[model samples]
Target: MVKLIHTLADHGDDVNCCAFSSSLLATCSLDKTIRLYSLSDFSELPHSPLKFHTYAVHWCCFSPSGHLLASCSTDGTTVLWNMQNGQTLAVMEQPSGSPVRVCRFSPDSTCLVSGAADGTVVLWNTQSYKLHRCGSVKDGSLVACAFSPSGDLFVTGSSCGDLTVWDDKMRCLHSEKAHDLGITCCDFSSQPVSDGAQDLQFFRLASCGQDCQIKIWIVSFSHILGFELKYKSTLSGHCAPVLACAFSHDGQMLVSGSVDKSIIVYDANTENILHTLTQHTRYVTTCAFAPNTLLLATGSMDKTVNIWQFDTEALCQARGTEDQLEQFTEDWSEEDVSVWLCEQGLKDLVGIFKMNNIDGKELLNLTKESLADDLKIESLGLRSKVLRKIEELRTKVKSLSSGIPDEFICPITRELMKEPVIASDGYSYEKEAMENWIGKKKRTSPMTNLILPSVVLTPNRTLKMAIDRWLETHQK
Candidate 1:
């Protein structure tokens, strides 16, 4: 039941990408303008329709530290902006007459990497904003790029279905055919080493393609002049090509968006699809979770952005050891199981419900098609187990409606504060806002005209849990 919290409008054309900084939400579009909106008040910043690009902007991203915003456009250039002043800090232009497909910042924020339609990858030093290194791939058209967590290696995917990994020393580590049709997106996920874990399995890469499948790969370093990449698994659910993918901040969940107009959430460790969201009307171009929040933002061809908050709790629990029918045995009578199954209101044409003491009221409401689909596989084996698994999956999804009062919003940002804290003045404010007010503004208490007793702020755990509950129940 994720609800749409807001729909930002201003672009006259297609919205290409949306990115978040510490204080701003930056969006770029085919309108040729990159707009900045305040995360605090949810209002457009003053003088913000950055119009330096002559053509449609293709991608936008904020550096890891949130100090700089970068974008690439069909105009063959990637522009870096100093977000504090809405001014262009530097422009890295390619004269190859092709759209600069994508741009991403290194984990340290010291370097910017971009891939272009001409198959060129350029790295720029953030201090001087000058070209640090230029490299090319043999496949020709580049579509996606990402940096490993250690910032030691970079990966790129091509329209010709090839994936290449490059070392920081300006050398290619591994290049191979990654997808059948071509790669549309790629992301990285890492796992903390535990006892008995394979060292090479610590780093995993997820990539999607026009083949309508997502692949996970195990990445490891080699002692020689290269790295080893091995296929981990293939995920299949989307009917159309998956155009975008992202790993949650903690790397516990992996989400993918497809031209099929749906998004799929997966349990990264088990490769199980936790949910398939089908609320968007057109191609879901991009999807991203808030920095450290459960809130997910998605853009579409329908000229809108949707904020979806998911409850991964139920999915997590289903994976836990607890189960209602865990004690059931094959010898359990059908009459005994019918009592619980009847409550779910599913029946086969064989009148299994009717024979099992199901009332006419429950029997008449049965959805024949859905019942038949699941029951059709019962004859093969494990009829009771199949029924239980189906019921468990259905129980994980829920829908609810609720709203947050204005008192829950932060005073600085009219938008709902995902994290709230209290200052020494005994007033609640968004954590970042309180920090910015005291450190950047060098001001006294925001609530009183006196000097604060302490600059330290305490987490409002009560409010944070309340917000989390609200988001989970009212997810759209």
Candidate 2:
């Protein structure tokens, strides 16, 4: 388990938002104050407390550049603060609303989107502090809103279980009833490479709600391509309703915190519960990952900020060759060899191998010799053993490879691979032919351009020789 380095107590009430700068942490609490602390020593800095909000500050977030911090409050106002001097840069107010539940800066930091209890989602231009676009949800309050990473789209989730997707112009492009209960939170993942028409897959939304469920949906242009319910898988061990959830930077892992005073980490793709963090004594209110580290900081009603660092090296080490083999077999058994003589027979054979009574080195040597001579054996002592081992490996490989289709295509380009190559074109080719073509087409011009770009030496051959000598020394 990882340990919290230090605890800095500054908030009198629950801390709702905690954001990290390069070396500082800024936290906003219901006490209507924003505190900045040095990350190195967890000591408070001598900055002015932001005192603009008349009510509790409910949400706060930092701009992508980390130079500005934005906070929203129940007083119906959002304030942007300068990180350098702790000065209030701008204050934008909503005409009518109960409170702003969430606010986010666009990836470009050009605009801000705020969601409020009045069911209104407003987009504000950062420069003018003027509302550029506004849209409404019908039945329930807008609980969460997020801008797509590319700035091409945005999505909002409401307490009525409705999820709405809007284009850059603030037009409703897609809307759907996504859950059984009120949608507590929603986020849009940067589009992923897929075998679909769009190069970017938009609205890979992960949502948690009062239904005690966490769900993932793949939304494209407002259409639902597919969705998976992971209530049991993601919130399995927790008995309370989930209150907060966030996807990791890579979008492969999700961390969810609940009112049950527990935080569960899930494999975003498989929806498998990875670990349950049980340090908070009260409801976990929010969680965020550091910009460039595996360190995760979570805040809760327990009046504490728990920082958890993922045990990446330990996870990798735990997944050794034996674990890999077992995983391979488990996947194979589920998808292949169902039409064989009998399931029981295959199970029995696998069970025997599980016992692993045979000498591994002897089996390997015998198998190699048998393969070399077209299954012929001169030594009777090892012949049967070699044949059995070879048969086992062949059976396993066959079962494993059968479920996978031939003509594996690139998920990005939607083209069959000719040869395996990672390209600057943002697509990976799996086939040799495609790779060869791409390489030949792109490699020629770069080499020719580089020759002229190289620096020239003095007119004499001595200078060239001297330059060559220097290069040789540096190369060593």
Candidate 3:
């Protein structure tokens, strides 16, 4: 459930974008100004209504640490502002002198990227506040951009319906047509999924466009294979063109706003709708999730920004009931198995299952031979039916373990390491495995494929502690 917490009707014209940091909220508009408010009280900051942009402001984003803010404008420049004082830190002019449409900061806050109407993308050094590198799309205006959580890659979407992926060095890695009409917005989820082989790491990317559809893609990266983007699924919930989409900080939920003047919140994993919001009176142009809260901020063409709070307690209760039934099949007792058998129309087998005390774990281990010999089932069809159900249970259990963190897996062994060590290349690896590789006179870094400067390895106590904590929590 969602509740309207507060509404800020301050902008005189259409609100172009809205962003939230841990403690503050920001909104920019066609009124040619940006506003800041404190999340604690929903009160406007005293030095707010920042007024440097000479034309309409198109987009605004806060740095990862919430210390600085970046806003782009039709004036052909993107300005970096000091969040504490609302003072301009730097003004970067687009090389093509075209109106800047979108801007984003890298996850580490070391780089700032801005996209312009002339199809040009500029990477800026956040420390020096100077241009670092530049690239361009082939056909249309660059409208959307997002950085992957690893900070090694980023993606840009253009009005020509193309999506381009680039590495941190500003080199194009891959390009493809993602939408038929035009791409408006895109985002990368922070959660990483382990590819079934455990050798690859995959992140989900959601892209929405003027084609009135949202597409999810699986973006994987490996040391040897580099990056690969594959189509995953499509979401067709909105009746009109979707304008904006954002993943929650946990990456479990996705919220999107559309020209239909509605917002749809979805369970990111299942692609199921959680709720739909229709409080906005005009086209909803932008939406964002707070860094560390259940609050959401949405901007609309009606010149207002609305803050919505989700009832997470209620949501958790509803999902908990469903999870108990669908997930953790290995924890079911004998009675639970009997009920499931009856539900599957195997009521006649319940007597046999109870006589043998077949619990969930034993049921999942039942093979054709076990069903025929141990259970003493005479019918071949009955054995096949039991085996098929067991196979289905095994498949579901494997999928539940797909969310293991990539950092926990050693790059060389492709498995969780008991002793993590940092090598000269600054990448962690299993200690014994890395020592064997180094002993073989192979003086190269497995991750970067570069020559190692020294043969020393240090214990990665911090990474080891993190892995330990994760295991303790998940194992429970």
Candidate 4:
């Protein structure tokens, strides 16, 4: 399951974009500065708030090796920074003195691409910090860009809704009208998917735009065929203009943020919505996934960045994937049980559990009495906690076995809903969770991130009753 781990409110103005390295996070803002934070603790770096840009800092990205960072701005310059000292390595000015909107490092980290408001896209050599090549889009401002994993070709998206593909030599390979109004952002998945043939290099690219839709495309290249861009599918879930999109490093998920103040995560392969997250108070301007972890950073016009994390084991259980279920059930060995206990923050019990040789089957049968007498867990509170955790696992197993309907699960907790209540976002959530969320002064819908029109929560009596009936029938 996905969970919000932190909310950073450090930017002074609208956060334009955010990116993650293997260990650090970089966020640029209209406040005219770029902020660095440690991914380990989300603490601001000592030399953070890098402030050389004379205008709004529009975009930033870390190099593949995590040794350098690139930040572009309306100042008409893209600055390369030494990640170690937080010092500027080079400041390359856009040729036409245009506002730079986006910058990205090539997969190999040897080249960087900066897209400018004047439609100029510049390719800069990382080693020499010199201009490698330059090209421009035909129409409106160039706002978005990304490099293919092979670094053979790069794509640029313009405000005029055009997508142009260029090769390393700066030759325009393909151009097409991609969006109706304008293109907001685009990203290339790092992992290539199988095209059922060994000769073709197939990649997936996700692009979102002002038309409130995200489209996926199949980009294929070969020595003989050169390049081909084929329309794969269109995803329509956002009600307002889509602002940003990114693919997870593994290429299994695609996430997009929108003017609707919502972020939707999609199962890239099936083009299915996996989760809808609403936490940003204003329109989401940018989003990115960490290259080395299941972590996501989202920036918004509200000037805050939200960090989200994926619990892989919990997600597997939530999705009830057959293989994952089998791994978590009776098949789990003593070592597996120890690892799981540690993951559950029950490290103190690891010794006890190992000493008792409690495996997965034994874990499933654990109860308060079993914990207190058999395991000799003396503390009543500790026993209750262990029993509760075991019961949760048991419930998950049983639900998977009984085919629990999705509607019975609470979107927030990913558990069977109790006391479901309809919120302003037209989604139902557990009453206590919704109350806790509102109590924290987060007056936004948990699903859409939109401001609540009213704080009033109507009891979802119908859904509650339906869940009750289902549990009664299934529990027996």
Candidate with best lDDT? 3
Clashes of each: 6, 7, 0, 2
lDDT pick, better of 3 and 4: 3
Model 2 clashing residue pairs (backbone) = 417-431, 418-431, 418-432, 418-433, 418-434, 419-431, 419-432
lDDT (10s digit) by residue, model 1, range 222-307:
33323556565577568899998988777877889899999887767545566677877889888776675566767777666666
In order, what lDDT does every prediction score? 0.71, 0.62, 0.86, 0.85
- In terms of lDDT, model 3 sits at 0.86
User: Of models 2 and 3, which has the larger TM-score?
Assistant: 3
- Give me the runs in candidate 3 sitting further than 4 Å from their true place: 195-200, 321-476
Comparing 1 with 3 on lDDT, the higher-scoring candidate is 3
**Candidate 3 lDDT, tens digit per residue, 67-149?**
99999999999999999899999999998899999999999999999999999999999999999999998999999999998
Give the Å shift of residue 203 in candidate 3: 0.8
Over 1-476, each residue of candidate 4 has an lDDT whose tens digit, in order, gives 89999999998999999999899999999999999999999999999989899999999999999999999999999999998989999999999999999999998999999999989999999999999999888799999999998898999999999999999989999888889999999999987754313344668889989999898887777655466675655775688999999999988789999999999987775454667899988999999999888999999999999999999887555444433643358888898787667545587899999999998898888878888889999999888878867765665565555476544566677777889887876567888888989999999977658899988888865556556766776677
The model with the greater lDDT, 1 or 4, is 4
Candidate 1 lDDT at 103 equals 90
* lDDT of model number 1: 0.71
